[model samples]
Target: MPEYLVAIRSGRFDLAALKNLNTQRKDQISPLISVRGTSLQDFDNFVDDWGDRLFYLDISRQPKDLKEPRQQPDKPQKINILLERDLNNPKNAYENKRSFYSEQLEKNKNIVPVVSWRANDPIRDIARCAILLNKGGEQAIGVRIPIGKNGEPSNHSKEALSTILNSLPTPEKCVLIFDYQHISSFPSTDEDSWIFKTLSLAQNDYNIERAFLLSTSFPKERPDNGSSMITACLDWEWQATLRNSFEILGYGDYATSDPDGEMDFIPGMPTIPYAGYFSDSHLIWWTKKEGKDKEFSKYIGIAKEIVRLDYFHDDDFCWATIKYEEIASLGGGDKSGYGNNGVWLGFRINQHVAAMLNLANVNDSQIDEEIDLF
Candidate 1:
């Protein structure tokens, strides 16, 4: 069976009521911890008690009632029942979460911030958590790995990870958290499975500690009767180990701004310190594939370009009005363009070098002078 994290909230209930709920949770889950408030030591104590099954008690708010109760429960009971079951077997869930985190920590010592762009946007907010690899904080490193071009890990996720890991400072320690969206990027190893194998191999080679990978992309659809295998494949054990060394730096504060529907910006890419490193104007440019509608041109720019544009208002940062003839002379205009796609452009930017572009505003004239393609 799969394990989960179950949060119990205490409302206006008296001690007896709270006790009853706790008892029920304990019965549902073999081992449970009592959390009266939020304190590092208190949370750690609960973590210690439950081993991997430890969780939070949201007594500050009243426990909400479930509409249908559980999928297979009596009428009076109302709550996400499976969550209760996971509370009973939190070890499984914790371990899976821990495994990926530990792997990230070992690979690099910095805040690894990742982002997952919108489904069609080719940009995602994947990471934005700080990491403390060792006891020292000065030697910290930060990273941002884009999990997807639009809304998933990009085709070059492995290469992106490798690049970010290599750029960090040496002899670093970390306190990390995998923001919400980046966690989903863990399961698959690309079509060739090179990234997965490399990560697994690297974990053993380096004894890393403390990390977290959070995301909305966890296994929502599991095969029938393959629950056990699915959990194992997800590497639950390793996840727990990683979680043991992690702290919930904090969840992102997101509020929607859409009038019809609230479109919230969840962190989709991997976040590292000095994230805007790749946003240099020189690294930013638009390209169009050859042979496609010369009229409907596609913008092929670097991640830093997008990040810089986003940091400043769109009106402030306009695409350089260069002639197609100029872009075509470069790599993107002809039939034998950058890639096979009739109109696909790409940016070869990473986190470290991009940060320099932060001054693009103060030095717009200089930036314009710095970047000029044929």
Candidate 2:
């Protein structure tokens, strides 16, 4: 099992970040990648780039218009993929969906089916999937259960989970995930208590091999502050608190992007130039409104400000930091242009993953040094 889990949409920026991660960092993290409304060609491109790396592939949010790939590629090597889909799509017939899973399993020897227990989906349907996947020749499967809005499992979640688990042969082989979609604030004491209780039940009843608590607090829009803003890394703080209390649970978040998804960029719109830096516990942002400076110049200014911050790491820290320093050093006359929004996002996410990996492995004595390393 990976030490950290990151939930990200399967966009160009997100995929670029994952592709650029050093081999060491890649081994330590598993990305729950959501492929929503992506074309078949794009999906093939992702697989070709990723090669055989182990990652969770979620098509739960995929629309009906985007069809799954029918022609299987030549079997040079088995890909390590965890295939997942939600039963909430009323348009797709259950039998047809199951056939898709069967086809996927037949093509990729190492692919594991993930059974997601959504609150709105019927318990019987979830169980049927679990049973089918277990008998489909895979050694183990994944079970993802969503935490309710009240910051705890829904009242019937445990019972629903039990039904699904009973359908499988070995609970010990199951990978469990408790997903808390969008977090508005830090976890309260009561919320912590309930999470701990649910985790305990999962461990005691199933003796599962791995479990992760996933959520994100990244805002959908930048705050209306004047030139800059700072947001606490509440998701990290909450995960750290839980790890301190319970050592068994692993960590997961939506990377640096908002849980609702990335903001759409409008063409021909004069957007404010901004740069985001991820510190140990906060995301510091600097922005420049439209003014005398050109848009690219504004970005250069923002980059300069980011690199000068006290928490800023040197160029060797990661690819993003290197880019920050490079942008800061460019002369006004130089035509070397600052990258667009997707490019900047890729930089931020690359740095975020590296920083999260460092934090996850650091001890209490190393905390101070880790913060300074950011």
Candidate 3:
């Protein structure tokens, strides 16, 4: 009998009841499916113990089970494919563990498609991440979109997306990272709506293998349509009629706020928009002082200041330091949204300059802290 594991919320699950459920599940299988409900720890133990022999179903965890199996393909039926969202981030050990597993899966001859979601990151890192998945004679299809400061998709961003989709074959089974807009100008200008339209066609015409759309911040004015992120994505799916084929998953809980605060925006870094887009028009805030005045005048001024400061390598904020005195001496009221003393500034300054920021050692170069601006 082939075995499987089901993991759920720890506190809500009843251990004794699960033991019986496992028995029931096993009996129900024609030949018998050895399905078991266990804690995350035990599951990890099983993978460690079974190594490449155990196939796993991590309902909400990364694809770690795939790693060992992929590394050793001789272990067939060792893993079964199930729908799950394995979000990879360098910060979390568990997340990294699963990512490693997925990477291993890509190497296997078995064609298992992985659907992943990542906040927008640096261009080089994005390319590197995609390349890893394509290793060992495997091809990974991906779609990326950039979210703006207001948390909306920029005009040019939409168009760049269209080019990628339009270029793909209609019935494509690809790995898409929802709302990853790293490259500046995707395809060209005046193609903003192309993304939405192409996606519609992808679901309607091409019958896309899997579709993942990253949603925007919910609008408080529309209480009836809360959960905009999920809502927007579903709306696209439904209208496109691709809902049947696609499963939209949220990496972060919709009800809860993201603690990392705009995981896509790297502190003290400038992003070149895709071709056909105006790169200079958008400003990326790297420090709290820079975000102080968000109005057009303030925003534009700060953008220019960053260019100058980054050019000169000033001492005050060169290494992620906050210029309290410069801000305090301004003697201005804290109406900029940050409270008095500028404690409310949104981000920390970066210390690296272009000369100092080296991407060779850091596999993940999206972080501003690791990269130098000068």
- Would you list the C-alpha lDDT of every candidate in the order shown? 0.26, 0.65, 0.29
* Candidate topping TM-score: 2
Candidate number with greatest lDDT: 2
Tens-digit lDDT string for candidate 3 (270-374)? 422100000111112233122222232233333334344432334342222233223333323334422221121111201111111221123323433422323
- Against the true structure, what is each candidate's TM-score? 0.23, 0.79, 0.28
Tell me the spans in candidate 2 whose CA falls farther than 4 Å from its real position. Answer: 62-112, 117-119, 155-159, 188-192, 262-271, 281-297, 334-336, 365-374
Candidate 2, clashing residue pairs? Answer: none
The candidate with the higher TM-score, 1 or 3, is 3
lDDT per residue (tens digit) for residues 179-288 in model 2: 78788786653434777776676677767667888987755556442356655566766777666665568889878766554334435555555456777533332332
Clashes of each: 80, 0, 21
Question: Which 10-residue window of candidate 3 scores lowest in summed lDDT?
Answer: 273-282
Per-residue lDDT of model 1, residues 198-312, tens digit only:
4343344322232233333222332332111111112232243333333322211000000111111124432111111122344332221222223222322322233334223
Candidate achieving higher lDDT, 1 or 3: 3
